[model samples]
Target: MSSETKSPTPSAGLKSNLPSTTTFITGHNAEGKAIVLDSRPATWKSFENGVMGFNQIYTNPFPPDLNGDADLHFHDDKIASGNLGLAVKNGTVCRMVDFGPGYVCMMHRTQSLDFGIVVEGKIDLVLDDGSSTHMKRGDIAVQRATMHSWRNPSTTDWARMLFVLQDARPLFVDGVRFGEDYGRGTEGLPRSGNDD
Candidate 1:
């Protein structure tokens, strides 16, 4: 169990079976034309253990940099936040995640409202209050910055889910604002970067 372990890199012929693709569009040259920025296949970063799901297929560094009026308006792939999710303050993120059989993410919470859709297979959404719901394909879930976790109960099948995370105001209770809690080091289990 070494923290120095490296994650799996995608090869030339290795394509993920997940059906997720992102099409980026941006403004063009002085002619004021609309152009396609990058229309390549979606990239997947496999987990080091090969059992965890993939995270952050694409990221827009600045969510507020929507207009091309800023000094830098493009995405930067080199910025790594260590947390696999691409959520940013006052911005939005689009990501596709997959969970293999018997995989259960630890309970965690972020300051974002997540809109998730079960694209393939089935998964159980467990809440902080111990309430759990079984979600299947075509099911849409709206998570409102609440503590939760995902569990894939299937023994032989994988579950693919698409999520759109939008930065939101921090949850306030009793006049105290609590920030995000990733809740690492649970159950003596190792931390997985794909927890989102």
Candidate 2:
């Protein structure tokens, strides 16, 4: 059982109260035997000047080719290269995000379907139309391709959420195509190739 561990380090000017998240990858060994491949903590990348941290847990292209462990090698390469982006153009990505106390993310839109699940603390999901919904632990927000943002309402504790994003068909409303809008959170992250 091969393992790769990365200890979580708090970013400068921010201290997160959330614990580290560990991920386990399973695969088949030689002779067609199932086995645990890798188990380790997902590496976190600080963003918004330490107001937020993101960890890419796993990603794979749509219609994944699992034969011969090709997908496993692909994921390994992505981790080694450290080029995992916010969303995959023709794939799916699972990510975990930590929000600092009272941090409000910029209003942005992605051309993908997202399942955002609140894992810790409380958060407010704000929409472009000025409507907000308070989500507590175990609440899930199925975010379609829309303009939205996340706000951590607690001023003394951090919040965490897990998001599963899948590439979606181009979204058009009133003949206006809305692509990816990273807003103020574009630093150190690559576009998901859905931009218009």
lDDT of each: 0.63, 0.83
- Candidate 2 error regions (>4 Å): 1-14, 79-82
- Cα lDDT for residue 163, model 1? 87
Q: What lDDT does model 1 reach? A: 0.63
- lDDT by residue (83-147, candidate 1, tens digit) is 43436555566777777788787688778788889989998999989899999999989988788
Model 2 TM-score is 0.89
lDDT of 2 by residue, 1-196 (tens): 4755456544444457687778877788777787777776657777767888887787888878888777777767776786766778788888899999999998998999999999999999999999999999999999998899999999899999999999999988999988888887477677787554
Clashing pairs in 2: none
Poorest lDDT segment (10 consecutive residues) of candidate 2: 5-14
Taking every candidate in turn, the Cα RMSD to the unseen true structure, in Å, is 7.8, 2.3
lDDT of candidate 2 at residue 159, scale 0 to 100:
97
